[model samples]
Target chain A: MIRTLLATIALALWQTAALAQTNHQHVSGSACGEAVLRCASKVTPAFAPDGTLWLAWLAGGQVSVASSKDGGQTLSAPVAVTKLPLNLDTGPDARPKIAIDRNGGIAVAFAIFKDKAFNGQVFATRSADGGKSFAEPRPITSSSESQRFETIGVDADGSVFAAWLDKRNRIRAQQSGRKYEGAGLFFASSKDGGATYAEARLASDNTCECCRLGLAFAGPGRPVVVFRNIFEGGVRDHAVVSFADPATAGEVRRVSNDDWRIAACPHHGPSLSISAAGTYHVTWYSNGKARKGLFYARSQDEGRTFSEPLALGRPDRNPARPYVLAGPRGTVMVWKEFDGERTAVNVTISHDEGRSWTKPVAVATTKDTSDHPLLVSDGHKAYLSWMTKADGYRLVPVGDEP
Target chain B: MKRRLLAAIFLLGSLVAAPGADTTSDFKLKPFGRGSWQEVLRAHAGRPTLVHFWGATCGPCKVELPLLGKFMKEHAGIEVVTISADLVPDLPGATRAMLEKAGLRPAENWIFSDGFVERLRFEIDPTWQGDIPRTLLIERDGTITTIEGSAEIPVLEQWSTRQRAAPK
Candidate 1:
């Protein structure tokens, strides 16, 4: 009897501790002070198979995942995915990504800063019990060199794929006294519901080092990735690579010929989504002679060729960080633009398979510091997720203008 | 209430004098072999100097390079120093190649050493938030005028003329 009573007391103390640490603020415009800069900056949202909204962010050295069943009207208490001390890279393009499988499996991937020299390691964690707890984090890359700017996607068959910019080849070339222009795109896949992962493989070399990679599903078990590629003479263009299986990568096709030849990281990445008609809708930012500002195009023949680029946003406005989401309803593109005074979150919808788009509409405005807008969809409706100092965090449905 | 009013006046006075009090001496920067930031300031102590911060990955920075080269060539009285905001780990070859391609080889160049980028940015200018292609015009008397974007040629020429004609 005494042993049972002691166990009950221990359980009670644990519950009290958890309650004290849980976050209860679910409303918009909540204040996130300067101490939690990472949380405020990189808020990524995902939708589960059951239409439940899940949001993930970095706060106080831990990755927190929160769920909302009422279409993000209210959020449940956040659960920590990793308990260990972590130095997360929470830059605009290097935030943690969340992807949920059909079986309620939760996967989160992020880069851990290894040292003061900006070297980082990519790690992923999964929870099989619906976010009650998470398994130990697994390293996706084994190299000591920097591996960061990760993207995660979940296939319909409950498989998880994580891709990142890896610098192992660059390090090896430097050691051998050879010139390496840029890093390589490497990815690892888990087929058995995050239980085990295959060996990491390189998709392509000479990829721009600092931009985030985009990953989306072309079909069941088929994942496509797009990233900035470094061509001959440092021309940074966008390339698409599709894989039938996670381990084998197909040919890398150049998608955008912006000819933005620069040696520095723009911190801007492209967005890709496959429509129901097997066409790819891509949007990106480039100030090249081919097309300037934000541009959009579609490929009907599996990225072998693309339509002529259609420019969006005004020439005077600095439009950047475009994100595209294609669903059964249509394709929606959201981007941030800075008019001379304030920044506005603009959106345009294309109903006829990206052939034409409605005029751009400004949905949100903020003069304070804010994050790049992200889109999360339930396969029928797309919602914009943005966090700003004036507006806190909001999940506004695309058509439900306020 | 009287004491509070006096304190507010004192605060206003300090706010007005703050810019003159702050100088390059408050910062400790690594020398890039061209010279230390302080040495460059001291050498051109009584002349107008243009300090431009750029990075190899920045697209606009590359676009502005030829313009900056033209500005440097046209204006002989103003000192121009271009600093690469790329991290210490990034290879300097790419930056050198960009400079060569833009015909900006004659400009004095520098790159940031490996350190906390925010702290370094704060040391350079307390209000700066580490934006690239940032241009600053430091007058002969240590007054600093900061521009968050690319410098316009007309504005640069006007500032240079004003600084050169200002009584020291």
Candidate 2:
């Protein structure tokens, strides 16, 4: 009898240890409520200048930042970037964006709910001491009109650029008894790190309001932004705007001719990366007549024109949310595909500046709902960050294991 | 002491084995200015009802709203209720203004409350993926037909004709 009892106790102890190990490997930080858990799924990863991986996610009305020194194998405890009451809009196209400056300065921009109206204001916060602490958030847009779906980036000169969907024009048009076809794309920049921002300037008007904006540095202080623009006849094509001076309105150029003239929200946006040879690599989703799936294209003359759109993924699979990252050796594109019963995160790599791409490799699969896969690079190595109902959150290195 | 330990284990096991809270049937939709879906459905319980889900930012919704509005005005016996699926806490005014511009401001217009959107969506249709500009036609006998994309006029007209021919 004593021998049987001892065996039973040993088995129980072994199971307890295994359970603890599993939980520690998956769950990060404290447990959140169900609503916050869903809200916390949308994550953005950034690589600091010193090769530190920084991830920002929304949890329980706060924007939290966690750093992983060992290439995302282990993460430090999350530090609150802002403690104010935040109405975080978390989804495939809406989440908090983080940018690490060249001098180790950290900046985060997010959308906060207004008091009376169901509108949002773009707010930004910065940290000088790495990600240890953050300063008070300041409104990026001066006007009280609705502003959301912001994307932030830092240039080589430490200048912070933020572009978002602005509704000031819509409100003004309403006052004038005219219809503003869609929201306007506006931007603001901070020269001396993230201390203060200049007045917002309009990049373009009639932009699709629901899709996220993509921003990448083209030159020293010039940052290029890509968004869905509402062209004539309501064609929702992609437009590129290069802000040579953030205080002034720059020229807006149409990059893709995939005239996707639809009257619906795809909820998918474009991703951009500048190669070492000064070529701009962009990937976006569209069901146009010419291009019918996720596509990749490159512009050699800085968004003036683009190459032929190359379709990615299989024809039968429904792929959405494509993300691109340009490393020193190659460019990687990651997207999610849903095949009726299962969802898979797939990746395709290009070594010749997106002129050609390899066959897509499925990195992860889940039978439940999952967030869009994100790609972040440290100029040498590219990593994929994903969150799912089955695996919680994972930051895995892509293209490192052959 | 052994018996107490066994009892404690039994209680813990029962607590863990119990099912989660039932949130599927919580169908309380708030009023959007005046009317709610519940009241509209109850008033026309025996008649066919059409529920249209739309968002202000959706491009396809812009094209479909006017068509739906015209259909509603032309058809008399069919009950049409439009619901704005805009992120409840972010853009209700925009949605309302857009609907007004599109002439889709029906008397039974409504918007989902902030948060719990997934739960409410599941309650509406378990298989729905929350796509915008979706249409649903409910027959008099409680049969529901959900169309993901925009519904054509002929589809609605046929459904309306069948609904009228059914027994009251």
Candidate 3:
């Protein structure tokens, strides 16, 4: 709350005067210059049934997709999901989402800013014939004040479940002169790959609106989601919800109590993965007085009880954007750390569920801007998918190949 | 021809000259990077300033920014500078509109450059974890008070009172 500025003052003369310029084109060359996979600034990966890796990425103001036959060494030509460029939502948690169901169906979801007030709208499109083409993109829900941070997951029966933070209830409260806190968690399902969606329904209210929701399927029909929820007194903590089906919203279960109270957005979210051992593994960033920095925890009693939070990453390096995946080689976690020179993507592998983890290792490093590290598994192995400016798109396989 | 030559030279030199801020022209937002932090701080050096960080995606910042503009107006001695930490596409227009709505002009308006934002953030203060609505109250003697979330008016008022009480 109170700190002196001696260091900044010592460094005051280092940075010279800036011009009356607002042009960022020449100064900010961290972004690759095209709408292709190599030029992508943000990338999300999903593995197909046949071990093919499909990636949806945002680049040059366009959402494009490409497939890799052999473990991301090379990618097929990019295919545009939207014909014309749109005002994409490339915020901290906002990016293009992809889900590949069994029988090779591809579904994609992304958000775009609708107005200057920052009201957002989520769009969904699909490809029936592999990645050859895509249908026209449409809003995920009709009644939208602002819908963002949309997440899509595929069930075993090839159905896709979509969940997002929506502000429709906030608008309703505004009209009725009732005060509203945060946004609501809303969801829908596409039984026929994402060509069309069922009616959107409210899953939970007062969920933190700015962060992304962690999504994974429990069984064939059930979907589990972890999100930053707005508890009483404006405490934004992590919570998990299990759905009986696409339409039935389950009880909101508290994941952990970090007691972070703020009236603003974290931009940082949470990640969830359900192991074959049926253990629920989650990781997130929190600044609560009870805990700080990145942490990981697991639940084996069907979201009933969780182990003590296992803090991840070093304190001095400033660990952030932790992603966890329960895969063939147990649970894999990855995050980004800066060393005052280069930002490195570090990984830790746990062979015995979440009981313990291997020493964290830096699998990739870049000296410039980068995207959050995301983990994807191909039913056989887990892979780290990251996009960086110094290096291009990286798809390094983490953990051992089982 | 000589007059046109002089005008071109003047325009070229202005590019490197100080961030001759012009909020009237839709916000003269300079591209802020790691190397530009010193320059930004130098602009408000020796003056009691309130440096606030915000972004387009942050909802709470939208509500607090207009009030901050009013606070600066009410306190004529203290200066308020806002730096946009947005990394989104099509940002300049939106940022300008936000400043106009908040009435935070004639004050320095800076935007995060397109480099690795972590570097830019680290340069400002290595400990900042990129939290929005974060502000720093700089006294005339260069003492800084860091506010994590929104800045409380009482805190700002205390800083103002301290500055007023300090030796001129």
Candidate 4:
């Protein structure tokens, strides 16, 4: 009888294993709830010039900043930088990005969604005393109209640059500053650590209606901003706009000649990272026949010229929403690979700058629910944060194995 | 034959009601009681298990309970196990009251043992990070057919039908 019972158990286990093999892939961890934006999942870790870690995430719809003064072993309680008002959007705000200047001051920036749209202004609060406390949030723009899809970057000299998909250029005035309502990419800068700002300037006359703008600091005093550049022919291609200094201003330059022509907006925009050696590395997804998979382009002379683009993912992989982090010796690129009905996160490392990269490694196997895997590097240690159906946003340390 | 079936029901009921009854899946989960979950899984192995993880303070859970009770009643064969993920020991009484308000029968309940979140997540699937209100369906062969969140009755019935029709 005992032998028979053991046989039954073995049979049951085998049957389960076989059945699971069909629709299920053995994942590294068990799955949990559907994809959501929970309080604990937001992650934004920026390395100071001296290697101090400043991580920021959104908690209960408010922006929270935490500092790990001694590496990442311990993190301080998240202090709120954005005052999430009562009338703010119902769901938790998107994850906030943090940038640390040479002097150790941190500027955390995030956009608030209202009425099922990105209506809230992008705001940033600075911490002068190593992130122990944050100053009051001063609005990047005080316009009551919707100013959505905004991204911010702070230079080593304390100059701050903020860019977004602006809709202010149409013949007929649009409501809520939405891109579909006659929008283009616009930027604003603050000369003194987010204290005072200049008037918003239209960086690129071309832009996509649905994609968010990506802005990053190319060097100590320079800035490189990339967004979906809308052209005269309505061919929406990734455009790179740069400035020697935020105060002096510069014209936006269309980076690549992919000329992806699609009637509808793809919603996937380019992610740019500036390396320590002053190279602006960018990666984005385009489905135009000639240039399909994920593409990597870099500018050796700051923002002037980009090398021939390199495909990062497999030929058939629909790579979308690329997030790039330029490390000491390499650039880490994370993107979602759309495999038919399912989706998974892929990571690649570039050792010879953007010229070549390691074969893509599948990090997290997720469903169609995950979005925009954000890359954060503290120089030496790089981390990838992405939203999962079960856990809102999870942070995993990258490049630990090889 | 009908009498035999009734007799078997009574025998199983007595077996389940004996002083210890099969107090296994229904009572507060302990490490020892966890073995009973296997029995529960075996009993309902052919059917889908809707494991509703809820706390007393969750307003949304409260709003959805009546709907769940109706769903349980409508889907006769499916096993609807509502496990309280709450830490409070007094939760059992409050949970029972909430279920009573929703007109839930006594057969559809269990309180997760302490530290269940850590153990159960891995035990269910190594890839699972902890998230509550997690519903998983275990096939007769011990295969997990579908895993998702807060599925309503029709969807549960659809999954059940799909599981039954799937090739062995």
Cα lDDT listed for each candidate:
0.70, 0.71, 0.80, 0.57
TM-score of chain B of each: 0.73, 0.73, 0.80, 0.62
Could you give candidate 3's per-residue lDDT for residues A152-271 as a string of tens digits? 988877888999999999999999999988899999998889876788899899988889899987787889999999998888999999888877978988888999887767888999
TM-score of chain A in every predicted structure: 0.89, 0.87, 0.92, 0.76
Worst 10 residues of 2 chain A by lDDT: A20-29
Q: All candidates' TM-scores? A: 0.71, 0.74, 0.89, 0.58
- Sort every candidate by lDDT, greatest first: 3, 2, 1, 4
Residue-wise C-alpha lDDT for candidate 4, range A1-402, written one tens digit per residue: 332233223222322322222121112122331111243334556778787667675433345677666655566766666443211211111346677777877776665432112234455567878787887655565443445566777766677777776555642343445434226667787766664456777665546644556677766666777777766565667778777676544776667777766543344567888877778888877755467657888898766778888877655545566788886547788876655445677888877667777778888866424435887766677778675545445566765544
The DockQ for candidate 1, computed on C-alphas, is 0.05
Chain A only: give the TM-score of model 4.
0.76
Error of 2 at B112 (Å): 10
**Can you list the residue pairs that collide in candidate 3?**
none
lDDT of 1 by residue, A274-388 (tens): 9877888888877554666778888988888888888888665667679898865678889876653466889998888899888899999876546678888987688988876
Each prediction's RMSD over C-alphas, in Å, is 14.3, 15.0, 11.4, 19.1
TM-score on B-chain, cand. 2: 0.73
Worst ten in a row by lDDT for model 4 chain B: B15-24
How do these models rank on TM-score, best leading? 3, 2, 1, 4
Sort by DockQ, best first: what order? 3, 2, 1, 4
